[model samples]
Target: MRSIRLTRMDWRDPAFAAGLTLFLVIGTPLVPRGQGIEIQLDPLGYTLLIVSGLTLAFRRVAPTAVLAVTSLATIVYYYFAYPGFFQPSAALVSLYTVAALGARWTALVSGAALCAGLLLISFRPAGLPDRQAFDGPLWVGGWFAAVIVAAETARQRKAYLNEVEQRAVDALRTKEEAAKLRATEERLRIARELHDSLTHAISLVNAQINVAAHLFDRDPDRSRTALFAVKDASKQAMGELRSALEVLRHDDEPERPHSLRQLPDLVKASEQQGVAVKVTVSGDSPAVSQHVDLAAYRIVQESLTNAARHSRASTVSVDVRYDYDKVTVRIEDDGEADSSSVVREGVGIRGMRERVAALGGEFEVGPRPTRGFAVKAVLPLGRSEDDNGGTA
Candidate 1:
């Protein structure tokens, strides 16, 4: 019961209590009959005032009904020459309610009705004196117009506020969707990087383990060398994996740039896997854009990994040439005539192609005319100026 009381128009609402008090005070006959003002009430006059004031208790609930009932009662009182000002004020309250919540046509019709009713009273035999006829209707009509205007303004203001809130909600939803898309792209990039970095090293380690197992009894020294190679490959693979993961864990930490500087270590890793690799770099190593440098490194890494896994080549040669405007990388192997077919254009080849193409570079991989496979990439060079003040 207490909860229901709180939900309804209880005494806790200041507006509800205030409206009731105001109507009662103004509707009662308090003015004395002097100075051209009179308060002479028959039984009908007393009833009209009390009913008009009491109906205000439900003004918000049934505004149109209260207006109709109070207006009729007041009209009857005026027709019989009752002396009071309460009923007219009550009618004005009803007019405001209709303007605020009712349709435009309905409020306009109600306004017209009040104007016509007041005009009839003004022209009646017991109506206002000749001196007040002009000023009386003007003042009353102006006050009614003001009430309607105020109600319309409040309605428009409420609509404008609702529209503004909806726009803010839509903008926030768009921002959240964009953030999720970015997170998804970042995850895919990390997966691709991890796959390219580890597959070759792990493959080499597996080969060394097989070699050691085969030679264990026949040649203990040769077996020991193979075992050492396995350990080295395993450690190197772990170090590279940790580097990739550290970049993922702390995004703010700068990534170590992979370039020609790491080429010697890469060649040595392949050599341990029983492939003799010859590396040659002609011309100076010029500073290039970060993306270009990284693309170049990844292309070489993928090519070496593929050659080690597929080509039965005893000798592989890598030659890098740095021109004024571009850097060219070429890897060749004297393997079987079908060595190129061994390295299919799968995920590893596709990744290298994408990396080079994204930086506006050229990439090619195919079989040599005589015997062997060759992978070549030509990457464009740019001034190494990063967003940070230092060189890229």
Candidate 2:
């Protein structure tokens, strides 16, 4: 692709040189000149003019070389007193090309050499006036100076256009990076929600299944209650699944976001799983932002699920404290752990830790010094909407 682009550029320069050469060849004879004695057009004069015009095709690639060749040829043609004079169009173009290409010193030095060489011509071409000498050189130098200023202007404008294009590219790259990061964070959030909801709901369903199978013959009423509990757990799991999948719907409809306000329902679900739960709240939950609220509730749910599934604790205690600057959560169980066995962190425990840490909270989970297991977290508040996907 790059070579093709360069080839195209090469084609354009030759076309431009052809136009200027054709103009120099035809326009010289047609344009009227003042009354001055002149020698007829000869083969050598044509050679000089043609040589200068040909050099212009390489102006962009070798501006200084083209400038030197054309400037020398134009001075030689006029100094020998050709029939009519022609403009140094090729030389002028080469000088402009150098400046426009941002080679400032090369343009200036090459232009100075061109003007100086032309000035030395005394216009002694078959008895020409000395005053014509001054006028011709002055006009050429003036035109060269004007070309330099114009080239500088064009170069500055091109530079500005390049800068604007670069800025646009940078902004687009930054936006793409931000979108990728957001997608990764969103995937993590969805995973945590799924783990918490499914683990807790499935634990209740499994426990009820065991109860219903065991009591079907001995206690029909209790067995029916366990079956009803299984149905409710499945229904609640469906609702939670829908809620977690709401983002894919891309709607303005409200969401059933989890919060500490729903702890009673969470506790009842765990109790149904055969683990007694006691929840204590120290501060009002209304002041907590929804992100923090969702995180806190998921932490509690994960804690309860781990207790019922791993610890097999008969009783669990949950404490939530909302203070001036932060909220604290502590869950402990009474089930005794084996002294020789090592406790491993499952997906539920890791998900709980991630949830708290994402909210800038600190989390810890391990066997207690005296008894069973404990999970505690401290989540600071006052995060802005922009920080948490426009949720306060």
Candidate 3:
């Protein structure tokens, strides 16, 4: 029972209570008397008027109950005398309550009741003049119109607030989704870079170690040289792995630029694994943008690494063509099947594809009809300068 009362109290508004109080106080003297030409407040009549005024204090907390009590009091007082200001004042408040509580149908029914009560009071055995007679239909219609307009206004305001809140929630959700997507993409890219750089170096180390093991009994000097190559390859792989991991862990860390200048080092690094690489540049190459240059270098690096690991080819070609509008890099190996017959694409190829797509370039990797696997990349060098500061 207490909980039910608390729930009803929660629905009441302080503003409605205040309005009811003010109306009742100002209209208290309007209580009528018999032969209503003169003002007369008998003790009993004044006490009932005061009770009606006090009812306004709980108007919002119990609007329907307050309205019924006030209406009944007004009918009894006027039935013994004539119409008064308190009756109309209570009716007006009840109409406003109907609008405030969003009870349009209740307001309509109450208005009809008020009209019928007024008509019965004004016209009994004989009808009064136009000034004294009640305009039941007109008063009912006007009260209902005012209540509906007020209720509709309240509904529209509530709807507008709800819409604003929904939009804010949607915007926050969208930002969260975008951030998650970016983090996932970054993780995938870092994984690919690590695989491409470390796998090739580790393969070289393995090959050198095998040679040293076989030659240890025949030629000690050659075996020592092979062991030295294995140590060097292991160190190189560790360095590349650390660098790639550092970039992934700390976004603010500065990265050294890798470009065409690093091609010689890359070629020598692959040679340690016994895979010969030849690089050639053709055409009066257009000046490469930083992004395109970096992309071109990585493509060559990943492709050579794949060839060394998957294709048992002795010779691999790195060809770069710089034209007026675009720069293209091609890495191809001669026909030689490696130990593994099933060709598998590691994260390296996926990273390469993402890189090229981000730069609005094209990447292709597959076996040539005549021979071994090949990787081809074509990037628009002219637009690279414009995309320099842009994000993918």
TM-score of each model, paired residue for residue: 0.66, 0.87, 0.69
List the global CA lDDT of all models: 0.73, 0.79, 0.71
Model 1, range 66-164, lDDT digits (tens) per residue?
A: 778777876676666666455566666766766666444555666667667766776787666777654545655777788778877876787688799
Residue 79 lDDT in model 1?
Answer: 63
Q: Candidate 3: which pairs clash?
A: none
- Candidate 1 residues lying further than 4 Å off, grouped into runs, are 1-26, 31-113, 134-137, 156-160, 219-222, 248-251, 274-286, 310-392
Top candidate (lDDT): 2
What ranking of all candidate models by lDDT puts the best one first? 2, 1, 3
* Model 2 C-alpha lDDT per residue in residues 1-392, reported as the tens digit of each score: 00100112387788887887777777777766564655666788777777878788887666667777888887888777665556587888878887787776777777777677766765455544776667766777888899989998998999899999999999999999999998888778778777899878888899999999999999999999999999999998998888777866764434546788899999999898888999898876536676787788888989898888888899999999988788899999987664444668777887887888787889988888777888898988755343545322
User: In model 1, what are the clashing residue pairs, if there are any?
Assistant: none
Colliding pairs, model 2 = none
Assess candidate 2 and give its lDDT. Answer: 0.79
What tens digits encode model 3's per-residue C-alpha lDDT throughout 48-87? Answer: 5655666666666777777777767666655555335544
